[model samples]
Structure formats: C-alpha cells, structure tokens
Target: MKVIAVANQKGGCGKTTTAINLAACLGKKEQRVLLLDLDPQGHCSLGFGVFNEDARDLYDVFTGEAVLEDIILPDVFTGVDVVPATKTLQAAENLPVRRDERDRLLAKYLMPIRDRYDYVVIDCPPSMGLLCFNALAAADLVLIPIEMSLFGMHGIDRMYDVVRELRERHGRDIPVRVLPTLVDSRTRLCRQFLREIGERFADDVLPVMVQFTVRLKEAARQGLPVIAFDPTSTVAVQYGRLANETMSMLQDDAATDGVGEPATGLPEATAAVQHNNPANEAVPVLQSHATPGGMEESRKRLGTMKRVFEEARSRLSRQGGLQKVVLRFYDFTGRDVKLAGSFNDWRPDQGVVTRTANGIVEKIVMLMPGTYQYRLVVDGLWQEDPSNPEQVSNYSGGYNSVLQVEEEHATEHA
Candidate 1:
C-alpha cells in the first residue's frame, strides 16, 4: 500500500481539509482508502460525522492497550475506513519510548496491517512533535498543503527544511508535494503566488489548486466531505482530481523504487518484516499498483513540466451582478455537453451546454468578474474548449480552458 502524510507545522493551511477530502474522493473512485487521524484536536473524526467518546484512539494502540486492527472504523464512507483520534491523544507529547527510538512507535504498528488498503493517509497535528515524527517515519510521501497567502512560501520553506533534516537524521527517504490550498484567483496576489510556488517547487508542486469556498466549511460542519455534501461544487472536483494525481504519484514511485521502499529509520523491523506475529500475518500480502519501470517515465514527464498557467480570455461582456459569457463548442456533436471547471465545482450536469441556432454547442455562463478554468464533458469525454486558445495543465495529467469574466464597464472601457 502507498502511504501519504498530510502535514504542516502552521495550522489552517488546509492540511486536514486536504487529507479528509482526498481520502473521501479516492474512496469514491473504488480505491480502498484508510485515514489515520493523528491530530489531538480530532477534527478529522468530527468532519466525517464520526464520534466515539469511549472509543480507543491512537494513544491506546501506542500504549499497548489495543491493536490497530481493533480500532479501524470500516466503511465510514463508501470504500473508506478510519482510525479516529480523540482529545486524549494530546498526551503523546509526554509519552516516552521504552528504547531511545522515539519515532518508531507508529511505524511499528502500521507495518503489519498497511497492506490491507490501497492508500493510508495520515492527518498530522500542526506541530513538530512526536506525532509528526511518527507520521514522517511511516509515510511514503509527505504532502505539504499551503494556504494561498503571502506567508505561504515561508512556511513551506521551513517544512521542507524539516523534512530534509529528518530524512538525514532518521535515514528515511520520502517524497514531498507542495499543494496550493484555498486559492482565490480573482486577486492578482493569488495568481502571482501560484506562479511563484510552481516556479519554486518545480515538479514537487502539485498542479491542482484547492479554491477557497464556504461550501467546504459548510460540508465539514455538516459532518461530510464537500463531495458528499455537494458533489456539484468545484471544490469537490478539485479534491477528486488531487486524489487521482496522488495515486499517479504513488504508481510512479512504486515503479522507480521497485522492491517497495521500506519504512525508513526502523532497521530491525524492515529486516524481519516477513516474520511478524501470527495474528498480524492475516493481513494480506502487499501488492503495488504500478507496472515495472513506469515510475521513471512518469517522473521524467513530471519533472519536465513548467508552471504554464492558463491565461483567461474575455469574449463577451458582463451584466449587472454577474459577467455573462456564451461558450460556443464548434466541433462537438455529442448528445450532451456538460461544463465542469473551477467555476462550477466541476459538475458538468449543473451547467449544461445547449445546442444553439448557430449549429454548435453553446451556453451562457453568468459568473462574477474573475478568472476560472473549465472543461467540456462531451459524451462523457473531458475535452478542453477547442476554440479557446488559452489553456493550462491541470497537474493531474490533463488540461483546462482558462476563462476571464469582465464587467460590462471594464470591457467597454477596454
């Protein structure tokens, strides 16, 4: 199984949001996903509408009160399962290891049963403590979610430095992905920061950007992922796209590191892995999702990618409140045309592209003056707008047409 840890020392960077939504979306894709909540706040457990006041948290498993298997809440959402965290886990800060190996606690427990799922995503706390160390030790990839703010880069630089230091000290080598979170592209600052981040991280920066939305908060408050709360929302679609990109990253990692890279730092366990206790032996044999030699090619393609963001285009004028632009599809003869993009939560069904009198697929999208990215679901095949010259990579191995909505005054004045 591929393991990912969503971590950031600074809180409110969409770390938990990314972890929760990505897991839920991956589960919806028929992948067996396991979410491990290591944060003391228990936000993940609460977000999923799951409550276990008397249930065992990760603390119990670490203290030997319960095995990891006994605590897994299976089928929490479709194909997803969870290992919830309680407020009691805050005590991990003071917990001491029997030996000097403080970081091996989580790796020891996860080693046995990790093979049961396709992905094991850990939601880490907002500090650099034993909990974060444990997650770092167990993860194959470290996803650093950054909010779209001026201070975003500084935090990422610090986190990246921490990961590098940890790898050197503990001998664990894990990949890191910089994901831009809660982006508001209407502002020039947001656009500039995205361009700067992509330039700074190169291939390490994920192509997907999670936009800021009230629906995400509403979904969390309602005890469900945004996708579950409102699948028609663009934020849901972005999370789904993030999941696929993450899966692709792992599939690539597996091909590059064939024998499957062991959980770094724990030497004895890695050597004696085949001889785990009988009870834990029932855990199925681990298998990789990537074919041999595929990761190298994927890596090359990823590394060669430049931060070519789509520049928006304005063809039509705006009305009072919302800018109205008629999207015209010249070559589509499909039965249905659905427009899904940054604007409409990637729900093609919500905004249907009609066949106009001009003998082509056409539809009017009334959006506030701003920039957005979208694609047409023509006969279920996702296609970029053919007539639109401005397009950019979606970072999940696809393209999205960039659109700019300007107010009538702005258009007329220009």
Candidate 2:
C-alpha cells in the first residue's frame, strides 16, 4: 500500500483539511483509501462525519489496548475507511516511555492491513511527539502543509533534519513533498512567496495551488471536506486534481519496482508495447465541454471575473491593510532544502541555501493579518524554527514556524 503522512508542525495550516478532502476525492475515483486520525483534536475524524466521543482510536492501537481492525470505521464516502481519534489521544505524549518499541508502533499496526487499501493517509497532530514519529516511521511519503509567511520559512529546516535522521537511522527512506495551503493569489506578497518557492525548489514542487476560499471554512464547520460538501467549488476541484496527481505518482512508482509489478504478461517483446498503445497515440483531439457558440463567451466571462478579483485585491493591499512577505533562503549545509507549509504548493523548492557569505542564510516575507506555520530548507531539509520562543512542535518531534498578525490589519482588509 502507498502510505502518506499529512504532517505540519504548525496548527491550522490545513493539514487535516487536505487529508480529508484528498482522501474523499480519491475514494470517489474508486480507490480504497484508509485515513488515520492521529491527532488528539480529531478534526479529521469529524471531517469524515464520524463522531464517537469514546471511540477506540489511534491512542488505543498505539498503546496496545486495541487492534487496528477494531478501530477502523467505514466513512460516509465510499471506498474510504477511517481510524478515528478521541480525546484520550492527548495522553499519547507519554506513550514512548511506556512502550519498548514506541517508534515502530504505528508501522507494526499498519503492516498487517497494508494490502487491504490502495492508499493510507495519516492525519498527524500538530506537535512533534511520539505519535508524529510513529506516523513518519510508517509512511512511505510525507506531505507538509506550510503557511506562507516569514515564520513559516523558519520552521522547515528543522523538519528536514528530522526526516533525514529517520531515513538514515531507521532505514526508512520516505519521499516528502511540501504543499502550499490557503493561498490568496491576489496578494502580491503571496504571489512573490510562491515565485520564490518555485525558484528554490524547482521540480520538487507540485503545479497546483490550493487557493484560500470561504467554501473551505464552510466545509470545516459542517464537518465535511470541501469535495463532499460542495463538489462544484474551486477548492473541491483543486483537491480532486491533487488526488489524481497523487494516484498517478503512486502508479508510476509501482510500475518502476518501487512497489511490485503486476502479475500479467502474455507477450515478452514489442507486441506488448504495441498492445498498450492504440491509433490515438499519433493523433491529437480537442475535447470541449462548452457549446460552440458559447465557448468564447464563457472565456470572456471568466477573464472578467479574474480581473475583478485582482482589481479589488490590489486596492485592498495598497490601502495598507495587507503587506506582502517574501522568504528567501540559501542553504549552507550543501544539501537541498524544501519549504513546505500552507503557503507554497507543498512541493520541495531550492529555498535551500547551499552557499552563504556570512555563515547565515535569510528569507524576508510580507504577511497580512493572520497566523501561519512554516519550516526551513536546509541541505535538502525540512525543519522548524529554533529561534522563536512561541514555536510549537509536531507529533514527529519537528518544530513549526509560527506568525501572529495584528487584528486591526485584518479588519482593515475586510
């Protein structure tokens, strides 16, 4: 099975939101998906519409009090199963001391049922504790959500260090991708931050951006993913796209011996290649969903809406209501660093500072009124902030970069 841990040291960076929506979208495509809620807050479980206050959850499974089969529940979305979380999980902070094989607890629990699902998505708690470590240890890949802000950049270096250490010590080489969440493209600062991420990370970044939308908040309030609540919304569409990309990546990995190969082979030569291709290979066809006469009109309308949104946002930014934050990094450790969070598209970027003049690399960014989480890019690293005292750690023992914006500025923008 392809396992992914959705982890972000900073809270409210849309980690649970992405996990719920991505899983739901994958399920809609007829993929068997298992979502594990490793967070004590149980936001992911609630997002799946599963509310059992006393449910036996990850806490029980990790503590050896319950089996995986007993905790797994079918979600409202077809082909999706969930291991819900409960308040008892808050005590999981102390689980490492109680168990001899604490770090591999989650991996051991999931191994038995690995073949049962096509994808296993874990929603990790915001803190870097034993629970988060277990999730990372179990995962073949990791997705980090970063909030686009100066502080967000500060946290990525530490996370990278942890991931690197795990790979080296545990022999678990997990590929990680950083994703930007809650993006507001209208802000120049947001756009600049994205551009910087792209310049730094290069091919490690995903092409899609999950824009900030009110529909996301509404879905959260309704205890559902945007895809389940409003499939027509932009957020839902973007999540669906993300699911498709993830599935494609998994399939590619499987085909290349990353997993195992399919068991059917009738031909051993060029005929097998020909059998996979058809006459359509050499021809390009245009597919259109719009009526011939209405296509141009629809395009014009979309253009108008885009211009209107940009105009309004520009006005707001110019009124001193919101300031842009640009984060730049130079990795001095001679390794690649990935900047992940709610800001960039959750892909690895060059934000790594390989050569520095004064023994320190820096990034500057402008942010509007709000709180955000981010991490640094060290020699191909992902880490949290070390200098900030208000920093919070994730369940994986990684720190988070945090930023708090002024309320007055937020109101002015509104």
Error of 1 at 69 (Å): 0.8
Off by over 4 Å in 2: 96-100, 255-414
- In terms of TM-score, the best-performing candidate is 2
Q: Write the per-residue lDDT of candidate 1 for residues 284-353, one digit (tens) a residue.
A: 2111122323557546533432222212212112215445567776665646778886555567756443
Misplaced by over 4 Å in model 1 are 98-100, 170-172, 255-414
Model 2 agreement with the true structure over 21-139: per-residue lDDT tens digits: 88898899899999989988888878866778988987787678888988889755778999888878867767555444666777777778878898988998876677887787776
Total backbone clashes of candidate 2, pairs 3 or more residues apart or in separate chains: 64
TM-score of 1: 0.62
* Best of the candidates, lDDT: 1
